[model samples]
Target: MLRRVRRQVADTLRVGAMTLYYLARGQRQRGAVLAQMFEVGNRSVVFTVLTLGFLGAIITLQAGFQALRIIGDTSLVGPQSLPLLVRQLGPTLTGLMVATRVGTGIAAEVGSMVVTEQVDALRMNNAPPVDYLIKPRFVACLVMIPALTVVGIASAFVAGMFTAQAAFHTQPAVYARFDVVKLSDLAEGLSKAVAFGAVIPIIAGASGLMARGGSAGVGEATTRAVVYSSLAVIVLDFVLGGLAFLVFA
Candidate 1:
């Protein structure tokens, strides 16, 4: 088990490094990157918005209810939740969504290619699969995840404001306070977004590259990609959040 884990980790790191090297050299196919951006960003916008919006509304309603019960006032609910939403909920939830949606798509696509020997054909032609397959997706994710995070944050904040206004009779001005947020908070959130984006493609692509067997292998790789990518996002959130607390506290 430990050996298997070690090998998977090694493969992931290797793929990540090669993808970064290609990206740094600007060796990616621009059209492929643009297509992936559309896939990662445009296709994901409505899902991200709807999911985060409902989550924000639910959270605000619960928080306001609790605050009203405890303190006879719900005015602070929005102010308090805003920082949490900006720094944690926005990026983390978006990362999870991407991990499930984009990660699975990447893995399935590459794994299918592997099972079909398409990757082997590329190798036969002396073409690096990492440069062609992973780099474009890596670039796209890096660009799009932060943008998605921002969209998610705005959606959630607006939803929370409306929920608070309707549920607790709180004014929009009070529910939309930004004074509690700081540069560090924004930095922390965006940092997590970028980090999650960087890992998703590399991990998913690595899983696909390691696929074996046949159709079953592709399925296994897709499942592994979703699980590993989601785990990476959660672990990164904890690590980055801790660092932010220690540094910015």
Candidate 2:
């Protein structure tokens, strides 16, 4: 178990180093990066919005319920939910969701390429896969995942407002007093976005690059990518969340 863990960590570091090396390349591959950005961001927006909207409703209902018991009114929901969502829920959920969607896609795509020897074709053509393939996905994931986190937070806020109004009689006017998106909170959330964004592609790409066998290998790599990326997001949240509290304190 320990040896396997160490091997995985070593693999992750090597892939992460390659990601960083290509991340600094100039605009020669801007088209690839932009294409990946759209795939990672625009294509995923609808799913994110819908998911966060419902999640916001559920959170608001629960917050309102608890606040009602303690404060005799659910008016506190507006101010309370934003801080929790923005500082914790927003980045974490966005990371995990996108890891499931985008990470698996990345893993399967690259794993298939590896298994089918398509990566070797690129090499035969004198094209480095790191530059032509991994860089775009790495850069795109870093940029777009944070943007998705912002969008998800906004959708949740809007949904929370409606739900709080309908289910708890906590007037829409309540959000007028919502002061939770403070600079400190924003710092925490954005920091998490950055960390989680970086985590997905590195781990997923590492798994894909290591694919063996054939179609069975690709499937296994994809599964490992999802599992590792999901776990990384949670573990990172725990570590980064602690540092955020200190940094933002």
Candidate 3:
């Protein structure tokens, strides 16, 4: 058991070292990385925007109704509810969505490549597979996830505003309380995005790299990557949420 534990620890350290090394040297392949990032991030923009927009509309309408009943005035709902959606719910939901959507794709793609020996082909050509594969995805997801989060927040706000203004007849300025959205909230959202972005791709890509056996192994790795990455995002979200309260409270 001790020997097995030591081996596992050693393998983890080795993987960590390799991941760091590739990340450090990733800049050399900036063009490829940027291209991949654009493809991955941009491709997913439509879905992210649509999903967030719908969510925002739903939250706004529901919250507005509840607030109206409590205070006998609908306008109070706009101001009271926007902050909760933006500060608490928006970023967390956006990060998780991106993780599940794109992170799984990364893992499955890389895992398939490993199983098919495509990664070996790159290595045979003196191309480092990590540099060619992992770095671009890592950089892309990290950069794009935040952008996606921003889109989600904006969509949510716009949807909320539309629902409040059109459906409930709330005044425009009632929802325009920019003062409520503190810099601390923005920082927390950005921090969550960054942490999530860093985590998902690494977990997915690493799982793919570690895949053994044949097609079955690739499939298993792909599944594992998605599961592991999703769990990591959730755990990190909680940790960041707590930290956000401490830092911003």
Candidate 4:
């Protein structure tokens, strides 16, 4: 089991390196990156917004209630939570959502091509499958995930503001404080976003490329993509958060 895990890790890293090499060399399929960006960014906007918005509202409402019960004041709820949202919740939640939705799609698509022998065909034509298949997706994710994170953060803040006002009678001016936020907070969030974006496609593409045994293989690849991508997001979040603390605190 340990050997298998090591092999998988090595494979993932190899794919990631190749993808990065292609990206640095400016190799891409025409229109492929644009299509993937649409799939990753435009298609995901509504889902990210709704999920983060409701989560923000619930968090603020609960915090407000607890604050009122303990101190007869809910004024600090927004000020306290805003920094947490920007530094932790926003990027983390968006990464998990992308892992679940986009990771599965990437794995399944690539796995299908593998099973159907399309990848072999590409190799026969002297086209490196990683260059043709993974690079575009990598570029797309690298560019779009940060954008989605911004949209998600905005949505969550707006929802929290409304919740604070309606549930605790806190004024918008009081709840919308940005003085608590710092450059380190933004840096940490964007770093996580970029890291997650880079990792997801490589892991998913590696899993897909390893697919065998036809349909059953594709199913397993899809499952691995989602599970591994989500785990990567969480682990990266923890690592980046700790680094931010050590460096900035």
Candidate 5:
């Protein structure tokens, strides 16, 4: 069991190193990068908007309720909810969403290529699969995940405004007016997004590259990719949050 664990860790590191090496050299298919970025960002917009909007509304309602009862100020919800969402919830949730959706998609696609021996064929043609496949994916995830997080965070505030008005009769601009989300909060969130973005594609693409045993293996690879990347996001969020607190607290 320990041997297997060690092997997995070694394999994961090898995959990351290869992908990073390719990323440093720049991409061969500029179109591929743009297509991937569109897939990662544009395709996820509705999901991000709806999920985050409702979540923001729920948070606003809860915070407003508590503030109303204790301090008789629904506007206080802005300070409690916006800062928390911007610094932690926004990036973490965004990462998890991308891991589940985009990570799984990348893994499944790559795993199909593996199961069908397309990757081997590409290599036979003297094409570097790592540069062609892994690098673009890594770049797309790193670039787009943070952008998606920003969109989601902004939408969440809009949703929170509606919820706050309904629950507490608070004005819509109360959140911004209070200056609750400092620059540090935004920085922390974006940093978390960057960490998560790196985690998702690297793990997913590596899992796909290692796929074997035909179609069943591809399915398993897809599942493992999403699971591993999601777990990585959660662990990273905890670590980054702790580091942020240590530095900023």
Candidate 6:
């Protein structure tokens, strides 16, 4: 059992190293980088924006009610919620959403390729399939997810401000008076995005490559990719959040 555990650990490390190498290679391929950025980031814009907007509205509404109950000042809701949105919720939720959407898609596609023997064909042709398939995805997720997180955070905060104005009848001056620690908050959010982005696609893609059987195998790989990648992102969020607190607390 111990030997099996060690073998698994070693295998995981090797896979991680290979994924990193692929990402580096993909980064140098300008066309692949741009294409993947659009594929991963641009394609998912609607979902991201809608999620951010909903989050903003809900948090603003709830906080306004809570603040009115006690302090009778609804304006504090925006100020209170904006930082929480950007600093903690924004990046983490965005990452999870991407994992569910892009990560599952990647896993199923690659798993289908594997099960259909396309990966074997590439191997027979002396082509490194990882370079063509896995690498672009890893690089795209790392680059584009962070960029999407930035837009999400901004939208959530701004929409929160708007919500405060519309729902609470608060003036823009109330939001303008809010104190946001932009640098530390932005740094923490982006850091979470980058870490999650790198980890999720690799988990999905590698699992896909290991897929076998037929349609069932592809479905299993896709499900595992979504579940594991989401879990990993959540765990990494706590780790990164703790590290940020230590550094910027």
How are the candidates ranked when ordered by lDDT, highest leading?
1, 4, 2, 5, 6, 3
Give one digit per residue, the lDDT tens place, for model 4 in 143-238.
999999999999999999998998889999999999999999999999999999999999999989988889999999999899888999999999
Error of 5 at 39 (Å): 1.4
Candidate 2, residues 1-249, lDDT tens digits: the string is 788667777998997887777667523664888999999998778988988888888899888888888887887788878988898898899888899889998999989999999999988986677667777888899999999999998898899999987887777887545565788888889989999888898898888888889999999999989988999999999998899787777
- What's the lDDT for all of these models? 0.91, 0.86, 0.75, 0.91, 0.84, 0.80
Provide the global lDDT of candidate 3 against the true structure. Answer: 0.75
What does candidate 1's lDDT look like per residue over 1-249, in tens digits? Answer: 788668878999999989878777745354898999999898889999999999899889889888988999998998899989989999999999988889999999999999999999988986689998888889899999999999999999999999998888999998888999989999999999999999998999999999998999999999989988999999999999999999999
- For candidate 4, what is the TM-score? 0.95
lDDT of 3 by residue, 1-249 (tens): 677345434543565566679777644764877887886688778878888888888887887778778876776665666666666677777766776678667767877888888999998987787777877787788788888888888888888788788888877788767777778877777888788788777777777787788888887777767777777778887898898899778
Taking the tens digit of each residue's C-alpha lDDT, what string does model 5 give over 1-249? Answer: 677446555766888898878777745775888888998888888888888888899888878777778888876777678888988988988888889889899999999999899999988976677888888888888999999898888888889988777777787777555466788887789899999988888888888887898889999899888888888899999999999999888
Candidate 6, overall lDDT? 0.80
- Over 4 Å off, model 1: 25-28
User: For residues 1-249, what per-residue lDDT tens digits would candidate 6 score against the true structure?
Assistant: 677345434543566688777656533545876787888998888888889878877888888898899999886676677667777899998988899888898889999999999999987876576777778888789888888888887777778778888888887778754466568887888789889888877888877886789999999889878887888889999999999899998
Judge candidate 4 against the unseen true structure and give its global Cα lDDT, from 0 to 1.
0.91
Against the true structure, what is each candidate's TM-score?
0.96, 0.94, 0.86, 0.95, 0.92, 0.89
Show model 3 residue runs off by greater than 4 Å.
Answer: 1-17, 25-27, 212-216
Clashes of each: 0, 0, 0, 0, 0, 0
Q: Candidate 5: misplaced stretches above 4 Å?
A: 1-7, 25-27
Candidate 4 — worst ten consecutive residues by lDDT sum? 20-29
Give residue 162's lDDT in candidate 4 (0 to 100). 96
Pairs in clash, predicted candidate 3: none
lDDT for residue 10 in candidate 6, whole number 0-100: 54
Candidate 3 Cα deviation (angstroms), residue 78? 3.1
